[model samples]
Target: MENWEAGWDDGEVGESSFDYSNHTKSQFLDDVERRLKLFMVRCVKVCRTLPGSYDGQHFGQQLIRSSSSAAANFRAVRRGRSQKEYFAKLSVTIEELDESLFWLETLVSTDLMPEHRLADLIDEGYQLLKILSKSRKTASD
Candidate 1:
């Protein structure tokens, strides 16, 4: 099992375990960045388990591309040149994550992979999406 998958089993990434109440902005962002990176790695690992068929290859490639892009853009957000740059990068990161979620859903909807196998990753994707969206909204305000 991947680290993120293990995370779910261990209750490390569960909703109750995701507390950031006592964290400073920098600490929260840093933690998010680490999670994003791990998410990318987990996606790649999942893709590797996909069948080598046409649909599998297609969705897997798209999944890897979007998840990796999301991670990279989020990293850029951390080093953003200004507020405008930060918002722009964050927007791209959100967009990429949305795409990643789509690909993941497609994989399961088309019966490429079992839904149960991907439930944790899909949950994590949505969780990350929510976290980033709230962060962007908070920053904008």
Candidate 2:
């Protein structure tokens, strides 16, 4: 038996077990979820420091939606029943990730967020985009 299969419950083994490397997928998704949560936390911190004004509200909402959507769409992609569905869901994930990055850039450029503080989260967002793009391409083929 494979090293991975050795730890599994005998009764739980099935075709799906062989079809997907759950360990790998779970690890990747966990990383994605972690980054998304971190992004949201940073957004909240920046938003709190901003003046009570319309710009703050608008920017906060955009950041909240995009950051949250990344994880939501990633979950949807994992649950997809077909390759087509998976790619479609991943496309949304990519879009949301990009949108989050855009908002982060805007925040920095507009001086709402410090560039030094936003650097790490922005890097994470770019990495996620690269990962999602690769996944989407693979699913499409």
Show how many residue pairs clash in every candidate, following the order shown: 0, 0
Compute each candidate's TM-score over C-alphas: 0.87, 0.75
lDDT (tens digit, per residue) of candidate 1 on 1-141: 211121122233456347765566677778888989998999999999999999899999999999999999999988988878888998899999999999999999999989999998899888888777766776676
TM value for model 1: 0.87
Across residues 33-107, which tens digit of lDDT does each residue of candidate 2 receive? 565667667766766676567776788788878878877887787688876787788788889889988988988
Runs off by more than 4 Å, candidate 2: 1-23
Candidate 1: give the clashing pairs: none
Best by TM-score: 1
